[model samples]
Structures are given as C-alpha cells and as structure tokens.
Target: MILAIDTATKWTGLALYDGRTLLAETGWHSTNTHTVELAPSVDELLRRTGIQATDLAAVAVAIGPGSYTGLRIGLGFAKGLALANQTRLIGVPTLDIVAASQTYSEGQLVAIAEAGRSRVCAGLYQWRGKKGWQSQEPPIIDSWQNLLDSLDGPVIFAGEINPAAAKLIRAAGKSFQIANAMNSARRAGYLAEIGWQRLRRGWVDDPATLAPIYLRNPAETSA
Candidate 1:
C-alpha cells in the first residue's frame, strides 16, 4: 500500500492506495490548522481504510513551490512515518502533481500555481503519445507577463490561475483552457500512482536530501 499526503497550501489531503485502487482519500481547506489537523486526518484515513503504517510500502508527499510552513509540516510527517515504518518515502514536485491531472491533453500543458503577489510557479509540458507529458521548462517562479512572453503556441493552462492571469493567457493569441482548480490541489490517489511509476523506474530520492522547491526566495518581489 502507498500512503500519500499533500500539505502544500491551505488544503491538506491524504490517501491510501493499494497499487490497483484507492482505499480512502480526504482533504480540508484549513491552512492555519494543518499543524493540529494533519496527524488526526492521517489517522482517520488509515482507520477508514483499515491500513496500518507498517502495511504501507511507501509514502508520497508533495514537495512544493508553496507555503513554506505547509511543505515542512507535510514532509516532516511523511519522513517520520516512513522512518517508523521502514518504508520508502517519495517526494513529487507540486507542479508535476498539478500537471498529472491533465495528462490526457494532446497539446502543450502549462501548470501554474499561485505564488503570492502577482507571480506564479509555472511549468510548461508537452504530451507525447507513449512518453506522456514531458516538461518543456523546469518549474520557475515568474510573473504572469513573463510567462505570456515566453509562450510559442496554443496551450492548456492548469491550476489556480487568477482572473488577471487568465486574461493574460487569453491575450497571448493562443488557444488556452483552464483545468479544474481541485485537480491542482493534489490528489492523493494520483500521487500514489505517480510515485509507483517512479519507484518502478528507480527514481527514489533520499529523504534526507529532499527539500521543497520554493523557486524564488520568499523575500524577493517579482516584477
């Protein structure tokens, strides 16, 4: 079984996946309460699924370009659980998790997560029939204008894009579609599926070396 957690923002999500199916999943949009609620939520999920920590083969978490406190809380919990259970821990980039939600798109895929101020953490991806979505540029923290200037063609935009950002995307003179915001929040089942794929390919990372991808320093302002 694979246990997945996402505390990348105000919303925290948890899920238990047994390779072939999702056993249980739950989430709450309580950013300020993660410190107190995360553990109980995890316990509730496991209880509902009748799975113990030691029964999990691995743990997956969203390592992010998100709220620093949220990332640390989620990662710390995941790492501790993995250590206690002697299971592998996997950290998936927040942007990649957002992109995975739109894996069925045939054209270019752009996953953008609100990065506070007027900037966003964005990644460009292209779907290949057999290879799946290939990232065009690694996730970067930048203004919506910068993202617009760099676009070459029609693209699908996914994640929590604001109205202003949406207008800019439309003005780029390219076909664009907004994916569901919930899809961007981090789906535990999807995280587990993706983690399983990476594990099979030997793409595991050392828990000690894993760190959240805060593309730009929190103190810096984007123009």
Candidate 2:
C-alpha cells in the first residue's frame, strides 16, 4: 500500500493506494488548522479504508516552498509514521504535486501555488506520459507580475493562483490560459500515484535528512 500526504498550503490532502488502484482520497482547505486537522484526517481515512499504518509499503509527502508551519507539520508527521512503520519514504515537491494534479496533456506549463505575503510559488513543467507533468525547474517564490514578464508566450497557469495574480495574468491577453477550478484543486491521489511509481522503480528519499523546499528566508516569516 502507498500513503501520500500533501499539506503544502492551506489545502490539506491525503490518499491511499493499493499498488494497482487508488483506494481512497481526501482534500480540504484548513483555517490555519493543519496541526489539529491533519492527524485526525489521516486516522479517519485509514479507518474508512481499513488500512493500517503498518500496511503502508511506502509513504509520500509534499515537501514545501509553502507555508513554514504547514510544511513542518506535514513532513514531521510523515517522517514519524515512516520511521515507525519502517516504510519507504519519498518527498515530492509541493509544486510537482500541483503539476501532477492537473490534466494538462501537452505543451509548457507554469504551476503556481500561493506563497504568503502577496507572493506566489512558481515552477516550470511539461507533460509526459504516465508522469503527467515533469519538472523543468524547482519551484521558486516571486511576485506574479515577475513570473508573467518572464514567460515567453502562452502557458497553462494552474494551482491556487491569487485572484490579483489571476487578473493580472488574464490581462496579459490570450497568451496566458488559466486552468478550470476543478483542475486547479490539489488532490493527493496524484501524489500517491507518483510515489507508487517511484517506489516500484526504487526512487525514494531518506526521511532522516529530507527538508521542505523553503524558497524564502525564515526571517521574512517572523511576525
């Protein structure tokens, strides 16, 4: 079995996969309640699916470039579970999970997710068989305008795009395409799918040293 968790932002997600099939999945936006919500959600999911932690052959988690607190909570929990169960662990970039969730079948894509304080996390990706979107670059944090100016032409913009950023992107004319709302929702089934593939191919990460892809200085987040 494969268990995947994504707490890359306000959206909290989990999914269970049984090697050949997705058994169950869940996702919701929390009100700064991930610390309280995540574990219960996982427990309920496993109870509903009758999956035990010891049954997890591997676990996949979305490591950040996202909320400082959210990233820490998710990775810390995932590592504890993996270590406890002696299961394989893999850390997928949050944006990579964003890209994976989309149905963009072709062409270049710019997957963006929210970064706190009037900015966004951005990455470059392209469609590929099985993997859906393959990373062209790791995710980075920048203002939406800077990201728009840097693009050469039309590209699919997906993820939880800021409304102001969405408007600015649309104002760029026909060159920028926004993904449908459903496509923009980040779901962890895709994360499980990606992780299962990696598990089969022997691509896994060491939980002892894995860290969130924090693109901004921690000092910037001090309140």
Candidate 3:
C-alpha cells in the first residue's frame, strides 16, 4: 500500500492507497499544531484501517513551496518511515496536489499555496487528457493583486484561497473563477494517486537526498 502525507500549510492531510482503493483519508486545519497532530493522526488512521506500518510499500509526501517547519516535519516523518520500512519514497510537488483536485477546464488552472506577507506561491497548469493537470511553469511567490494582474485570459484558481482572495478575484472581473471549497482543499488521496503512478514507473526519490522545494527562504515564509 502507498501512504501519502501532506502538511504543506495550515492544512494537513493523510491517505492510504493501494493503487486500486483509497482505504482512508483525513485532513484538518491546524493552528500551527502539525508537530503535535500529524504522527498521532497517522497512527489513528492506520489503526482504524487495520493496516500496519510494515504493510506500506511506499511513503509519499508533499515536498514544499510551503512553510519551513511544516515541510520539514512532514518530510522528516515520511523519510523516517520509508527508511525504517525500506519502502519507496515519493515526493510530489505541493501545488500539483492542489491542481489535481480540480476538474478540467479549457482555460488555465492556477494552483496556489499561501505564502505569508500577503503573497502566495502559485503554479499555472493545463489539463493533459489522461495524464491529468500538468504544470506549465514553476511555482512563484506573488501577491494576489499582482497574480491577478498578470493573468490575461479566463482562469480557474484553486487552493488555499481565502474569502479576501476570492473577493479580489471577483473584483479582477468576470474572467476569473475561484474553485469551490471542496475542490480548493488539497487532499492526500490525490497525492497518493500521483505517488502511485510514480512508484509504478520507478520514479521514487532517494530518501537520503530528497529535499523540499522552497520558492523563497523558509525563514521568511509561512507557506
């Protein structure tokens, strides 16, 4: 089975997927409590699903463009599990998880993760038929206003969008669409699915060298 974890922001999530079934999934808004909440939650999920740590064939984690502490904790936990279990370690880009949750649109899809100081880490994506949404560029740090101003055509925005950001998108005019809450929330199930694909293709990362992708210095960003 593949175990997926995402602690990319204030939101954190976990899931178990065996390629054929999504056995379990859970997520919550953490008030900077990921350190205390993540491991126990993982244990509970595994226990409730009657799955043991040894049963994991691969451990997948969202590698940053997120908060320093959050990314470190998640990756450290995942890496420890992989090393201990001798399983594959898979790292999925954080924004790709957000983009995967949305339905296909003819226009562009912008996946975003909150970056403190009124900025967001954003990635542009396009649907790739059976392959799902593929990122068009590397994620960047930009304020909502500047991000909106940089877009020229109809676009669907997803991930970590607050009401204030939604209001700004609305004010940007009719060409922009904010994803619904359900689609906007990043879930580890999608992360698991993506990880499963990579695992099948032998694209796993070396746990010893794998590292988080931070668009800016983590010391200055909150994710």
Which structure among the candidates has the greatest TM-score?
3
Per-residue lDDT over 1-223 for candidate 2, one digit per residue giving the tens place of the 0 to 100 score: 9999988888889999987888999999888888899999999999999889999999999987788888889999999999999999998888877787677544688888778787888999988876577888767888877888888665898898867878999998757888888888878998898899889999999998999888888667411
Give all TM-scores, in the order shown: 0.89, 0.93, 0.97
Instruction: Spell out the clash pairs found in candidate 1.
Output: none
Candidate 1 residue lDDT tens string, 102-164: 757656888876676777878888887776777776788788888878776667888777678
Mark the regions of model 2 whose C-alpha exceeds 4 Å error after superposition.
104-106, 128-131
Rank the models by TM-score, top first. 3, 2, 1
Q: What TM-score does candidate 2 get on C-alpha atoms?
A: 0.93
lDDT of 3 by residue, 34-89 (tens): 88998899999999999999999999999978988889999999999999988899
Q: Candidate 3 — worst ten consecutive residues by lDDT sum?
A: 214-223
